[model samples]
Target: MEKARRAMFFLLLLIADFSVAQDTAGEADEFHVGVILDLGSLVGKVARTSVLLAAQDFYTVHRNYSTKLVLHVVDSAGSDVQAASAAIELLESYKVQAIIGPQKSSEAVFISNIGNVTQVPIISFTATSPSLTYNSMPYFVRATLDDSTQVKSIAALVQACGWREVVAVYEDTDYGRGILPYLTDALQEIDVRVPYRSAIPSSATNETIMQELGVLIAMQTRVFIVHMSSIMASLIFTKAKEVGMMNKGFAWITTNGVANIIDSLNPSVIEAMEGVLGVRCHVPRSQELDNLSIRWNRMYQQDNPYESPFNKLSIVGLWGYDTIWAIAHAAEKVGISSARDKQPWPTKSSTCLESMVISTNGPELLSVIVQNKFRGLSGEFDLTDRQQLKVSVFQIINVVERGWREIGFWTVNGLLRKLKRDYSKKTGQASMLDLNPVIWPGESTEIPMGWEIPRVGKKLRVGVCSSEFTEFIKTYKDPITNATTASGLSIDIFEEAVKRLHRPLSYEYLEFDTADAPISGSYNDFVYQVYLQKYEIAVADITIRSNRSLYVDFTAPYTESGVGMIVPVKENVNTDMWLFLKPLSTEMWFGSIVCFLYTGVVVWLLEHLIGNEHVHVPFSLKQLAITIFSIFEES
Candidate 1:
């Protein structure tokens, strides 16, 4: 009977242990994470696929992890209000520990504020505005580079290509406008000028884009640095091509925002962007990346059946995939737990925002995420600085037929260098020769001049003047037609300058000469004519004077001017033996000696006659001569 009692107790203990084991096995931690994106856009679609795939792949590899990230995605639908609403819903309803995306920089602004209030970490792989700083939003982490990081590379490219001036064509949103200041400052550092900033609204119509392009084409500046979204960029380039602005003289450079997604742009857009140079983040090719691309292409096609089959993964997608891994690693390391059961923080019922509860695991999770370091598909995924990705290298690509070609690389240290070569940190201006041969716009091999001669308005009125010095300028009249004509050095130089413009310049030289046939009015009056808007330009033996500069601008003086005197070179030299005597005539010499003798006599007489004993002298010719010589010396 005692043995039966012992067996029954042992069975009861075994049952208790089994119950505990089953409860533990069934209770896997679900760490809720929110994802907000513009599902209607191409970038949004690609990022979504990459994020989902990354989560699946990471879990498949690390099945033993106690914490599982449960993603709750919400479509922002490309609206900032919608994105904000989505963030609030995720925080209030789902009680997410973290949030990813809210794609655009403008959209990230308000949503990031929400993250700060809730103490929930918000990580973004796409929003790259420099204004979204870590200091302002402590809970927000940028998994990709700030747009400002690549501005230096763009400036380097402009400098290397010898473009002195560029027009910044950008969308008038935070994402587009944020980089302008940095780009302008960088270009200024290199002595390059930002002549104009063309800010196109993101919602601008095709006609509006074309009108802006027309204004750009009419201006003298030919180089355009486009900083805008891929959609706007596509329309802009297409309109530019239609307007004949993609000719040989024009240069177009796109920032990484558009460049990174070049593969996903349609063939028509790619064709329109031919000969365009672009700066993009360089992701080193690897076997893992290749496999990701293959899988991504297949899965993307399956998910987006109606979309074009040619769509491929972009750099943003890589960043999104890497971001998932980063978050997952941080989650497992910090061991995040469900925060729903925690007590709600004090509130005043001042809207749903006030009633939200703060996550208990957010601060620790954020710390781990910012400190996480690992090799990701995009590059070194180190966010230890808690600001943005460290962008050391950027690829310089040239758009060609069907695809783009890698021409060179721009490194934070090396500036610019050709592919397949190791380069040291360099100082001074980078040269275009470091890159491979570039096929410029209109399929021309020649580098663009970055400017054009003004073609609008009436032909330039060039006033020519005649001078007495025919070598400088000569004006005359044809006896048969009585038409005025100009010739000589000034005419030749002016014509040559016009010829070198590479474009046709319609100009007629109006001869300004006096009726007496010597020359025109004073140069001051001729220059004043230009200032009065009578003549567009005046070419003659005109001197550049400070007084004239007040009214009219002057080209650099082609001919040096100043007062000069030329004396004949003397050949005969005076080698007379008595050259010293040539300074005075014989009569003059005798006169001087006589005067000295008279003066000596007067002095001697005064001494002797006055009975002064201080004067001592012998009554001899030698004494007399000495006295005269003394007088001469004194004189």
Candidate 2:
């Protein structure tokens, strides 16, 4: 009886051991993913909800996978330090396979650096700065389109409308500055000039924004390309309208940062943005996206009951959703045993210090993630070799009274399509004319010329050379009035060119040298006055020579070219007694009389030989002589 009891106890112990082993294996299949976000911001809220929903949906459809995603959420509190702390915690404590969020580019830089050392994949959906390039951070994956990608489209729009110059207005941040170089290059490629860049501090006050706008308003550029956060954009437009910059002839263009979130703006903000044009990422519509949008809206409304109805989900949210699913798909492909390996913590003396935990599975997981491609809510979810989401289409939206309206779409090939009907049938080159009619600033349909004379500023100071030689450039002063006037071929050409401008240009001509004397310096010195900012332009017989052009811009040459010597010649004497006889030398005068007699005799002989009735009547010697005399007289 004792042996039987011992065997039964051993059998029950074996069964319990097997059950514990199965439970351990099941736990190992669950992969941990960390989410670091600025939950205090509206974008963060939407992203957070989208990620959660994505994880739920991914697991439901992918139940057969050997690995499951277990998300760990942390709030960065909109602080870079907090984001770093959260990343460290998620990396060291939870040992997550991958991390997402820290929406801003500045925040992403900090976390991505940590991710590089830790060998964990850091995915960002909203950090669109070009500075966050994958070459710098191999483990970093940008699930959103880089800001630089949209610069070409913006440049195409500017070119199509024939805007000569553009002024970029951006926030003074990494996100804002990163796109400037690309935007400048793209604009230059299409023969557009970026005259000035207005950078507003992220924390700038309303007064500061207005001051910047005032400076822009006082300049010649009327076309403004705004590349900043939506909040800053709203303030800029608001202050612009307050200062009357929203009037006719002014143009405003925005990138996706502000354009994609137009629906979330307040009515007052929309009103301020009236007549503004913008570019937004284009996501193809599908049944799955439609259902997802409806679900996201309901969930957002439930999350924030005090806020107005959530009508649309931003591209960032869609990216968030897609990022979660991508992580899950990648994790599943990597398998449980390989993904759940415990990473090694760095030694005290290691280069990475306390932040040194190396993930054994990170490289493999990243490789899988980079290769993962699928159709998601935002559109096709293909990633470039750098792991950036491939975006080839963008919509140009115009701000109207009813809100933003789609005017056209910009493709990667640099074509603009007006509507779905046009896009489906589009062939050949795209043009600005293909876009829906735009209501320009001041509620006019006339296309803006993209420049205007400053309404409030000093008149342009034109430098004129006071010449001792009055033929080329002359300056005169009225003795009693002391009013200076300048007139010359150069001045006439300058005035004609100015008159050809679509608007009046206010200018005041200031003599570079005193009117009492000729210019003291060479022509180059006069032209250099423009470069020295002493004058806005120098108008004279300013020769467009190679040396002069090195210092200042020159208009097309208006005067005849080439050089000729003007030396004095001795006057001829016409009143001399022998002047008439001087026409012939003594031998030449005698020779000329003999030759005339010979010619008259030859003519009379030819008339007698070849002529008919007239010659017959003149056959008499006296008549022939008379005819010869008449012929000589006629000659």
Leading candidate by lDDT: 1
Please give, for residues 1-635, the per-residue lDDT of candidate 2 as tens digits: 99999999999999999999977765537788899988777678778879988888887787667788889999998788999989888877777888998789999899988888888899999899988877888888888898988997898888878888999999999999999999999888877899899999999999898889889999999999999987788788888999999999899999999898888777888898899999999877788888998888888888767775734688888999999988888887887676555656657574535645678888888988989988788887876575565577889999999498888888854556543444433322247777788888899898798888897989889888866567777987678986668997778878998999899999988876553444444566878878999999888776577877788777666666877889988788478787889868999999988987888777767776886456676257777677667666778
- Please list the residue runs of candidate 2 whose C-alpha ends up more than 4 Å from where it truly belongs after superposition: 1-29, 64-66, 338-340, 349-356, 418-430, 463-497, 511-533, 537-635
Per-residue lDDT over 1-635 for candidate 1, one digit per residue giving the tens place of the 0 to 100 score: 99999999999999999999987885658878899999988899999999998998899888778888899989999899999999999988888889999799988888989888778899999999999987888888888899989988898888877889999999999999999889989999989998899999989999899889878987878999999988899999999999898888999999999999999998999999999999998988899899999999989988889998878988899989989998888888877544554556666666767767777778888999988888888888888877555677899999998699998888865555564676776644445776778898999998898888556535668887877788988887788986668888988998899888766777766766555532334677778889888888898888778898999888887786776999998789789899999889999999988986689888777667877554455477866666666576767
- For model 2, give the 10-residue run with minimal summed lDDT: 420-429
RMSD of each: 8.7, 9.9
State in Å the error of residue 577, model 1: 8.8
As a whole number from 0 to 100, the lDDT of residue 264 in candidate 1 is 93
